[model samples]
Target: MNNNAYNINIFSGGAELLFDNKRHYNIDLPNKDTWKLGDLLIWLRDNLLSERPELFIQNNSVRPGILVLVNDSDWELMVSSDLWYLICSLCQILCKYAPCP
Candidate 1:
């Protein structure tokens, strides 16, 4: 395990269709002393997202109706003084989307 790199697992629920229909992914992020959830989002959008990026990203963040979970916890609950949450090594990120009627 590279100390500077973070190996993370990403899972997609209903949103997997945008990721080539793959539900799980293991990826290594470039070395950095600190990584924020926002950074990860950009990385996913640039690297993992396969199609229909508009449906996944909006205003530099995930579009409405998309749920992002880090280590099984809702990202919204993890926000603090800084809106962007910190991410650690071996973290698990899940993106789920629930369409509205």
Candidate 2:
């Protein structure tokens, strides 16, 4: 499978703390034509998560507190386990999850 590049902008509301306090990333996901948002979450955990992975993902999905957006649209609007927008699934994900204070 070939690698595909995607960009995800993180906010303090999400897992930014685990990503070096950064907020922008251009990541790559394998393109076997079978990747989905669910798969992406796992990939993030395995490849990008720096610490406390449980904070971002749990029970095979993103924790309840976090909110996910794609192309400025709610991820729930498009969270299928199939190829979503072959144009750029991972490229347009924006996550928000305010850490408990």
The best candidate in terms of TM-score: 1
Q: Which stretches in model 2 have alpha-carbon errors above 4 Å?
A: 1-3, 80-90
Candidate 1 — worst ten consecutive residues by lDDT sum? 3-12
TM-score of each: 0.87, 0.78
Rate residue 47 of model 1 by lDDT.
96
Give all candidate RMSDs, comma-separated.
Answer: 1.9, 3.4
Give the clashing pairs for model 1. none
lDDT by residue (tens digit), candidate 2, 1-101: 23577777664565688777788888766656766677777788898888898888888778888887877887766656343433455457777886878
Q: What C-alpha lDDT, on a 0 to 100 scale, does residue 67 get in candidate 1?
A: 92
What is the C-alpha lDDT profile of model 1 across 1-101, one tens digit per residue? 66535444455567888888888787777877788899888898899899988988899888999998888888888876567888777777888887656
- lDDT of prediction 2: 0.72
